[model samples]
Target: MLSDFLALFFPRFCAACEGALAKGEKVICLQCDYKMAKAGGLTDNNNFVAKKFFGRVHLQYAWAYYLFNKRGRIQRLVHRMKYDQMPEIGEFVGHKLGAALLRQGLQHEFDVVIPIPLHKSKLKKRGYNQSEYFGSGISKALEVPLDAGAVVRTVNTASQTKKSRLARWKNVDSIFDVKDMAHVRDKHILLVDDVITTGSTIEACALSLQHAGAASVSVAAMAAAK
Candidate 1:
């Protein structure tokens, strides 16, 4: 009752819409959730995301939960997770992603889930890795272990948002390094991130995992920018 009383004045807002959240609404409002979740996404094995890496890296499967549009619900949700100190948004996204795969009977296709790591400095500043929370939710719901150290971000690159497609590739090309080869080798790995834009970061990580003898690497994220 005390929490409810406090909520009366300090009302919670939806992470995606910034509208007042009703009772029982956790991160996003119901309307916004439905809008974002209705997207076709990368349900099929051959998808937009998978095509992005056709010549760059070999991916067994690649899919995202939603499309990332500027100023859209997905953008807002990702912004909140990355900048507004609302990391739980990642977990919510992961739950949805896992449920989607489960519905398609693709949840058990991977042996382990690993989030794209952040550099130590950035992680210290952010207090968490947004992708890690997403991975946590997927692992819990999919009954797969989340290996946080499967790959490490060795170089702290600048933001890829303003860079050109080629520039983005150059920025993140060699940023990831495989930290634990034992966990990656002979395993079907799911490499996750918060968003997929130019696909450079994901490609780089997939290549690193493949080079490390991972049987196959699958890509997953909350949103994929068309």
Candidate 2:
């Protein structure tokens, strides 16, 4: 077949392992996908992810897809998505996340998917919000609408990449503002993000939505530091 001929000439490598993908393999090879970490039981409302926000926010449900280890395979994939100018990576991973959540019966739980916002300046430079791609993937799989602009970053704080957990929390207060309440007021929103480091960013946005009268809020991310 023409596809087989093309495959022989130009085999694609897995994003995580750099191993040549066999038939049916996409961004990540089957072997890598099998070995990649998971965030664990998705149904527990009081899971590890929920514990992160204890005393800070009341999450309806909260979890991540994978464990984030420094310089690991997951980290490599994330770096490509965040800095290697590979936007499609976000779309693909998000789709996978959405599909998993859907299989777990979370499809009907949220009315809308909202990405944590980026300031206009950063969005312009990045050309897209990574979290929006995640939300879009969730929207497509779960058949829910994506409200990409529900929140706005009023202040462009310094990157939390190098900051300590306490410092990250200190840098994020009052940085997010909900753009409008019409859609969020009575909806249960699923807040999506790329990776959760200090949990400050997602916490801030979740509180903003709750304060604005969202019926409830849940959180999802591609990965989280262990």
Question: In model 1, which residue pairs have backbone atoms overlapping below 3 Å?
Answer: none
Q: Which one is best on TM-score?
A: 2
TM-score of each: 0.89, 0.89
Query: Compared with the true structure, what per-residue lDDT tens digits does model 2 show for residues 1-226?
Result: 3223434544487878888988788778998888988887587877777788889888888888888888779999888777766656566777888898889987898999999888889888988887887678778889999998778999887566787777777678678888888989989999999998778999988988998899999998888885
Clashes of each: 0, 0
lDDT of 1 by residue, 70-182 (tens): 87778878888899777777887798788777877876788999999999999999999999988887887788899998789988875667778787787687898898999
Off by over 4 Å in 1: 1-11, 37-39, 159-171
Give the TM-score (vs. native) of candidate 1: 0.89
Predicted structure with the largest lDDT when compared to the true one: 1
Q: What is the lDDT of residue 90 in candidate 1?
A: 88
